[model samples]
Target: MSLDSSQLSTAHSGKTDLVCYPTSHHILFWVNTVSYILPPIMTTNGNDRTTQWKTTIIVSTSLQNHDTSRMLLAQHHRIRFSDAVKSGSIVFPQSGIAFLIINPQELPENLEEAGLFDKIKKFVTVHRNSFLLLQAPFYGKKELDIMSVIQHRFLGSNLRVLPVRNNTEIVKGMLTIAKATSKPHVDSMRDRMSLARAHIIESSSVWEMLRDIKLG
Candidate 1:
């Protein structure tokens, strides 16, 4: 089935015609005959929960006219443009996270010649918690090479790499990550996790055996 923003809205609201199958921590949903795995914000009852998380996105002035920025605005996210941020960068201030969006097609064939490493180094230095959003239509050799180089160079740094196919994926990735890392929501997730852990311990046969042995 074809998926659009409206379909995403319904899916996010836990009301969708599409059948979703959970795989570990992600949910697999089919769109346009292609399956996509999305990490759902799950509640205590195992229901996918979202729509309550919202935060302002600080966009660089260079991306003011970009499709990614427009898509975020269309999704009803509050966007504030600033010149202080690096060009093609977006900041989630509440989460202390920043993302530098780069188009793989625009990158030079010789990465070192383009000084890509220096640019990324500056970006990481500016934002302690940062991500590199590498946009590519497909994960061809070029894309993989770029991702591999960045991952190798940034090892042990406060930087992560997210590969996005389109503007839709970009927005989805950003929102999902920002919501999970932001305030109040992160705390709530911790509480739910603790409860889940307690439930597991209470229901475990090993725990019961240990208790019986101790009592005996």
Candidate 2:
């Protein structure tokens, strides 16, 4: 599902942020690069324990992509998405994540596909409580339209149709997705709400966000 690259446009600026890359908000966008994008999105777990976990997960369209994300996140510490979840190193989110950082674009022909897009859509719809952040390339118009359809059809809350138009938006989008992943990582009951709040984003943390996530 390689995008046509001519469909995305910046014409609509009524109230909502249509042109996200150039003039969306405070954050910057970067492409094909990762540094410190933003702190992982986290939730205060309802079932707080003695350890106080910080589950940093990297999600994408396919499990393979998720694997890709896992390798990328390993540079930070002794953390991997699969281990974080399997070993309970990274607990699941309080409200399950319907989906996050999904791209329909094909990775390779010989990957032994498992009906990727269909499966992703199914998971997102079934798990209604989980947050779904749909990542889409902002090349031009065609990709944007496809993204719009996916967002509208999905039965999830606030299906965020992210615009990875330029490096700034891509970086900012990664920051947002990583932060969302943190809810499962630092799964603590107390201060979960407070932690989720983006009040104190540090400089170093911001750079981490850049490196952890990717853009198409």
Candidate 3:
């Protein structure tokens, strides 16, 4: 799905802290480039200590490629990487707001697929605090259909799925997530509620559009 104006506009505001990208070598290049453009830190309690705030970018993939994935990301000093094995083992920070990128190719054929679903469920459970970002597959429509199903499941878990069409959209989505998660404690609840409502509306619209296209 293409990113709407609101999504694109957010990138310029420098709001997101943690962002995850696909494990592909091509995506790794862009993810590394984007990480250099760090978002501005919002002052907390009127303090000017900028060193306390940090943005972490992570690369995620399956365990079969864990060694290669780490090697690919090793050159990028600012980016961290992790892989989720079928055994439900995943390595990621325990706490903090994160923008998780889910490449359609890296996911199971469908969310209902047994063993893979369990692994995914465990991964999501561990990073329940994250904002999931679903990127369209580099392939075509069939892959997108599968991605849509995965997107819906994440939404059901109360996690917002930010859709992106391209690399630019990915950056924008990350910033948008950062902005939402970085709100003050007093405003955080309201922000989350608003975001949840938006996701519900957006997801419903996307599915409806998909059904219409399929029928047509």
Candidate 4:
């Protein structure tokens, strides 16, 4: 499917955060220009366990043939295509997060027109933890404008914006965020983070200096 750029506004914004929650309140780390937060590789039964798990994603039937869906399938994810979902959207029920993928070129010139905000409002209502995937070939003036509008409109809400350049980025970002924010995986990541923090404190000169001051 192709989008018309004329109706799109310009946009841009990305920041790194390191919150360690396993839900909507989680960290967003940047790597290879894609937003991802993979934990350190762990071993189980002498097998290296990365974040690749058999996760299920409920996708809109409208995107059943979309490239993003195909990419996710290629990665061995279980995808259930549903007509009941909002068009161009996918849901990771395990994480309680839903992603609406929209090409920047598809957005209306103004956020208020064509009930865009209302549609997004309903989306966020249904999926308490929602993310808007702004897909574009690259971040240009028009893309940045739309992103800015989306951010402003959803400010202070659970709706997060993930700007993706291609189907690969879209699938990668969604899976990264979804996996990081879901169940046992999240717990494991937290444990690893705690261990790392303790290691840092133990190895740091600042802590040693403080200890010396206390002893003196």
Best by lDDT: 1
The better candidate by TM-score, 2 or 4, is 4
lDDT of 4 by residue, 1-216 (tens): 111222111111232234322222235444224344444335576443424566889999999889888888887888999999888899999988899988878776776876777878889989998888888888999999888987898898888887777886676667666766788877766555444444444565766888889899
lDDT of 3 by residue, 1-216 (tens): 343435533532433333323221011111213332222324566542223333444555443354323432443324554553223132223224445455665665545664544545666676656555555636477666865666666555735455556555554444334433443521543343334334443565655797789899
**Better TM-score candidate (1, 2):** 1
RMSD of 3: 14.1
Task: Estimate every model's Cα lDDT from 0 to 1.
Answer: 0.73, 0.35, 0.44, 0.70
**Candidate 2, residues 46-131: lDDT per residue as tens digits?**
44121223344433323434433443354342233442221111213432443344443433332225453464455545554333
Clashes counted in candidate 4 amount to 9
Model 2 misplaced regions, further than 4 Å: 1-54, 58-78, 81-98, 104-117, 129-137, 155-158, 165-216
The C-alpha local distance difference test score for the whole of candidate 1 amounts to: 0.73
C-alpha root-mean-square deviation, each candidate: 11.6, 17.0, 14.1, 12.3
Better of 2 and 4 by lDDT: 4
- The lDDT of model 2 is 0.35
Worst 10 residues of 1 by lDDT: 15-24
Off by over 4 Å in 4: 1-51, 196-216
Ranking by TM-score: 4, 1, 3, 2
Give the CA lDDT, 0 to 100, for residue 81 in model 1: 99
